[model samples]
Target chain A: MGIPYFPGCTLHVKAKGLDDSTRATLAALGLELTELPEWTCCGTAFPLAQDNYMGMVASARILAKAAKEGDGRLVTVCSFCYNVLKRVNFALKNNDEARTKLNAYLEENYNGELRVLHPLELLRDDLGFDSLKTRVDRKLKGMKVACYYGCMLSRPAKEMEFGEPENPALMEEFVKAVGAEPVDFPYKTKCCGSYQVLNNYDLVAGRVKDILKAARVRDSEVIITSCPLCQFNLDWLQDRFADEDKSFSKIPVLYFTQLLGIALEISVAKLGLDNHYVDPKPLLQAG
Target chain B: MTSEEMTRKVKELSGQNPYLCMQCGLCSASCTGIGVMDLLPRQVMRFLQLGKEEILKNRSIWMCTTCLICTARCPRGIDIARVMEALRTINLRKGNDILAPEDVPAELLAEIPQMALTSGFRKLSA
Candidate 1:
């Protein structure tokens, strides 16, 4: 069965590698991801004002499109997209007043039929870890990976029901399924200062430094995450930080799908492994 | 606006009762943007509870990255992040935006990811 996939705006532009690697990894696991037709951005962030019916309308339009296409489940790789879409879906289903107002604003009656899912959830819950193990062509033996969940993937537990909000292990289990060692760290669920990378790079750089330091202290070889913002902050900011501090060490950040793509024996170039600012090829090859 | 009017507006806009906040510093402690904010997360809530409308002009609300750590850790189950968003909404609705698109250098704009631009504009722009 093909899962309806929503590749948000960023994946199409800055994080094309995530989209490519995700498609390749899912294909290896015998799961087909079909892009939803005419999908718009999931508003990136959920609007929180009580009277912002227009913000809810923006997300409602996307969900209505998914339902109109007859898709029961909508899967996305971006944590921002996952968080916004899931929260909007939860509201449309649980809050009758909000749903009525949103439906009226969008001029379409949506019954909140589409279910939002993260790609990690699909791999962990839908496809068994054993199934993933069977598909791994190259075991990532001795590779110490810090599975960074960032903030959105599992937070505001009531809305995001992926796993344990504070201490999630879905990524760790997925890493182990591909025959790699998962390193437990304190900042696994820490915020990477998110969009502050745009205007306040210094703040994000500081948070990134702390997250990387935690991973290094735990003896992690590389950092793995599912969010593009987290991946960009952790991977791209290291060089900028190293220029300011001589003692700063570099750690390659890889998207979980990219790591899975490597274990599935997909070629490096095919997975865009060389596209990272800090090259992960050396550490990946060492594994 | 009077303090009572500001309190009523915040309560209506956020749908979160500021008075429910017991002045616990958990939200401030968990907030990642504590170093940057002019007022702490708990302070923002306290100002709202005290009906201090001056918080509306504070830059602390804009500094929030909406990480939700404060909301997740709040003992009173107050969605502090949402309150921050509500404050931003109130500010933006006044026809004043925190960022101007043209002021951003084209080169920097070209290099940054779309997620950052989209989310930033959504939060900071009118």
Candidate 2:
């Protein structure tokens, strides 16, 4: 399958591992990712705020790029970028007023009509679980892990409308395909308060505690998430939450791809599993 | 002069669905962080419906965490989260802030070097 790849800013900066692992996984699955030339930030959590029009225009700009880049779906590894671009497309494609405004902006400044897709959506909906299951060689058995959906993946499910936002099991099913136990927890769709980390560390840490605690109770060896922000807050903030409440529990937060990379017998280092704040050595070794 | 006029702007932006919010307090009741909030989710929706731009601008909007419990439980499906996001967007437009104070959260930021070296989770920032 050919798809225009849009790696949001974080994937290149903070969550490079996600990009690397996703690339490897797609390649293993026989999917070709064609990079969009000179793609810009999707305006992210910023545009929709500062200027809905500008933010959307920014999103439309990327769409125009993909549409012109020939024939291929625009696939993204970053949830934020995916939502931003997809939401804009939804609005522009459905609302004439929005379409007029966006088209004008595109014609004058931009050039593509690329449809956006989250990597998982592509695999689950396009590739089918049966094919994915057959491709799995290393089964991650006995690995007790929780799936954290965070905010963007399924929220405002109507607006984002990827799947069942309330309680999505696709990622869990994928993890299960790899042979790991996907722990079910309450805070799956809860917020990690990624944007609030600075002004209120205490609050964010408290929220982090709640998420990790739920996973811990389930005996999840490490929490797995698709969002970079959620993974950062859950895995990185374990210590602070613990400090805030010395009785705070600690659990490594793992990326879905890292685990996939491992199951495929890929080098752990190449997967960036060792880059986590919490040492998952115990958990991975235990698995 | 009237409370209705105060929320006129919110009413316009949200398309007046919030006007039907019966004050059932279901939003506040279903909110995950109701007790922790200064105005609660219901109150925020009410304020937005009435066009209380300043209240919508409150950092509390950003506090929502985007959990859809309020929407999930609302009888009308008012989408309280969207109201909060709109406010957050407006606040951001005015340059009130960027990267939410906890962009990376302290504990998480501290783990950057370690997570980078150990997690096999590629660090794009170098």
Candidate 2 accuracy as lDDT: 0.67
The value of fnat for model 2 is 0.15
Question: Evaluated with TM-score, which candidate comes out highest?
Answer: 1
Q: Which stretches of candidate 1 lie over 4 Å from their true place?
A: B103-107
lDDT per residue, candidate 1, B1-126, as tens digits? 788877777888888988899997998888877777889998999888877889999988877888888888889988888899888887798876677788567866776678888888888888
Local accuracy of candidate 1 as per-residue lDDT tens digits, A1-287: 48889999988878888999998888778778999888888888888888887777777889988876645898889988999999899889998988999888788888777889887778877888988888886558888999999998888788888777788888999999998999888898989988776656567877888999999898899899988888888887788788988998889999999999889888777687877889898876665
TM-score of each: 0.96, 0.84
Q: Candidate 1 chain A: minimum summed lDDT over ten consecutive residues — where? A: A196-205
In CAPRI terms, where does candidate 1 land?
medium
Give all candidates' CA lDDT scores. 0.85, 0.67
* Poorest 10 consecutive residues by lDDT, candidate 1 chain B: B103-112
lDDT of 2 by residue, A161-239 (tens): 7667778777887778777888877788877755455445666677777787788889888788877777777777666
**TM-score of candidate 2 restricted to chain B?**
0.66
